[model samples]
Target: MKITFLGTGTSLGIPIIGSKHPVCLSKNSKDKRLRSSILIEKDQKNFLIDCGPDFRYQMLRSNHERLNAIFITHEHQDHIGGLDDVRPINFNMNQPIPIYGLRRVIENLKKRFFYIFSKNKKSNVSKISVYELDDYKNFFIVENYKIFPLLTWHGQLPILGFRIENFAYITDASHIPFQTIQRLKGINILVLNILRKEMKHSFPFMLSETLKITQQICPQKTYLTHISHTFGFHEEIEKQLPKDVYLAYDKLIIYE
Candidate 1:
């Protein structure tokens, strides 16, 4: 299995518009992030996680040739905005891409992108197939792999985190339930989200809280994503992280 960090920045992304943040002004490419997303490849099949607004650019940059499915973490715009960009894939593959998400998320997608689902939809509209996920069930099969959905909390909203074998990916998460923690127990590679350094909000994990969770999960290796410029420069913050934890940058790839 190969996992690629397509984008690792928060909703607004790094260099937030015209902000003067030093991290944003840095010359390092790692400091420049698009939005949060990832590409997972196994058995020659590619699966995408969270097609945020930057999806098109990320795919182009990576030169991706195939995408079998997309697993959504939540209904937030930063996570689902790029669904429309799947048109090219739909055209080339001649099939609607299967997208898995919670019931609310599927409903939101239908409501937000009604044109895509409309009976009178234009020929140019992207094709999509919705798959409602039930958190209470065991892992489900997709292509050549089994996917387990981990129910987690992103503020007051319920979201999903996915577990495939010993690799788990979770983003836009604030609180993870005890049961979800148990599900992640034996993960060898854990991808988590840490929005910033401060803990003023509960919508996203702060650096301190992320560290505590990392210790508890105790994955052989942990990669932090959904980062913001507030977390500081990629190199500087990296120096502060524990040896087993890493700050994920766009395009970073891991193999198992």
Candidate 2:
């Protein structure tokens, strides 16, 4: 299986508009992050996770040709803003793309993109099918691969993280429950969100806190995503991280 880090920055993204921080001012391409999202491909099937605000740009950058499904982590605007862009693929394929997510997420999508779900509203048609998944449910299986959802805390709100094959990607998480940890143990690759170096935000997991979780999960390789500009330059932060842990940058690809 192959995984691509489409975007690794948080909701505000790096270079936060008018900020004068040094990391944001850097000219390096890796420092210019979009938003948090990923692409997973195996066999002939291609799937997307969290089609955020930068979705169109990401697709163009990667020259993506196919999209079979989209799995959402939450209902946050930054996570689902680019959802309607899937319409192009649907039009080309002449079929509705299947989207899987928690019930609240599906409801939010319906409300936010009501026009797409409406049969009478045809201004800009969006051909897509929705599959509402329950927390901790086994969903959308491929041969030899099944996705397991783990309910996690993103501050006070419940969020979801997924494990597929030997790879697990979790983001926007604050605290992972003990029960969820039981399921996440012994994964080959683990990706989790680690925000600022200092913990002051409403979000749950800070840098050190996330690392402790990673140590317990003990994946062969751990990647930290959903980064903020406060994390410092990509090269500088990378030098300080443990050998097995990596700060995921946009467009980075991993195979397992």
Candidate 3:
């Protein structure tokens, strides 16, 4: 399996509008993050997680040719804003993209992108099929990839994090339930969201809280994503974290 960090910044992304923060102004390309999103590839099939607002640009930059499915964590605008851009892929690939998420998320997509869900809509529009998911469900999405859903809390919203093979990816999660923590044990790689040094947002984790959780989970490697400019320079933050933890940047790819 191969995991690609398509984008690792928060809702506003790094280098927020009109801000002259040093991290924002840095010339390092890694510092210039888009919104948080990721792609998982197993065999020849591709599964995208959280098609955020920067989805189009990220796809173009990565030269993505096709997407087999989309897994949503929640219904936040930043995550779903780029849903419409999947049109070209659908047209070119000549197939409907399977979308998996919670029931509420499916409902939100139907209402938000009414044209796609319209019963008598034109055929040219992208075809998207929805599959509602539940926490703790373990099932095969593709021939070789079996996924387990881990239910977590992002403030009031119920976010569905995923465990694929040896990797666990969770974002926009504020608190993971005790049962989910049990499922996350023995992960080779774990990715969690840490918006800023502190907990100012309804979603995302406080740095200290995340560190404590990591210590307990004890994954082989733990990388933090969904970061904001407030998290400070990547190199500086890297100095503070333990050797096993890392700050993920856009375009980082991992394979096992």
Candidate 4:
């Protein structure tokens, strides 16, 4: 299996338009981030997680042949805004891409992308197929992968994380339900969101809070994502993390 970090920044992304933060002013490529997302490649098939506003750029950088499916974490705009960009791929493949997400999230996608589902509407002729998933009821399986959806909390809003084989990816989780924790046992490579160094917000898990959760999960290696400028420069933050934990940067790749 191969995993690629498409974009590792927070909702607003690292440079946040015109802010004068030092981290934002840095010229280092690692300091430059787009939005949070990833691409998983296995058996020549590509699976995407969170098609944020930077989806087009991400795809150009990914260089993958085609997409098999997209797994959404929630309905936040930063997570789904660039969904329309999939049309080109649709035209090339001559089929609608399958989108898997929670029932509530899928419904919200309809409202946000209403034109796509409407007939006789003047808009891009994009096509999509949605699959409403019950993460609590059963594990999802597709092609050569068996995916286990783990329920996580983004503040009070319930969200999902996925476990495939020995690798698990969980982003924007403020808390992990006990049942979900039970499912994560023995995961080798784990990805979790750690917003910044400070434990200021209850919505996004900060560095310390995320570390606590990492200790509990005890994966062989943990890569932190969904970073903010407040987290400091990528070069500096990379050194502070505990052994086996890493700060993921855009375009970073992992093989398993």
- Each prediction's whole-model lDDT (CA): 0.92, 0.87, 0.87, 0.90
Residue range 114-161, candidate 2, lDDT tens digits: 999997985877677888888474555733568888889888888888
Question: For model 1, what is the error of residue 12's alpha carbon versus the real structure, in angstroms, after optimal superposition?
Answer: 0.3
Worst 10 residues of 4 by lDDT: 135-144
Better structure of 1 and 2 per lDDT: 1
lDDT of 4 by residue, 119-211 (tens): 777867668899999757588877758888889999889998888899999998989988888888899999999888985997889898889
Best by TM-score: 1
lDDT, candidate 3, 77-127, per-residue tens: 888889888988897799888989998999999999899999898766768
Q: Model 3 scores what on Cα lDDT?
A: 0.87
lDDT of 4 at 241: 90
Q: List the residue pairs that clash in candidate 4.
A: none
C-alpha TM-score for every candidate: 0.97, 0.96, 0.95, 0.97
lDDT of 4 at 106: 97
Which candidate order results from sorting by TM-score in descending order?
1, 4, 2, 3
Q: Candidate 3, TM-score vs. the true structure?
A: 0.95
RMSD of each: 1.0, 1.4, 1.5, 1.2
Clashing pairs in 3: none
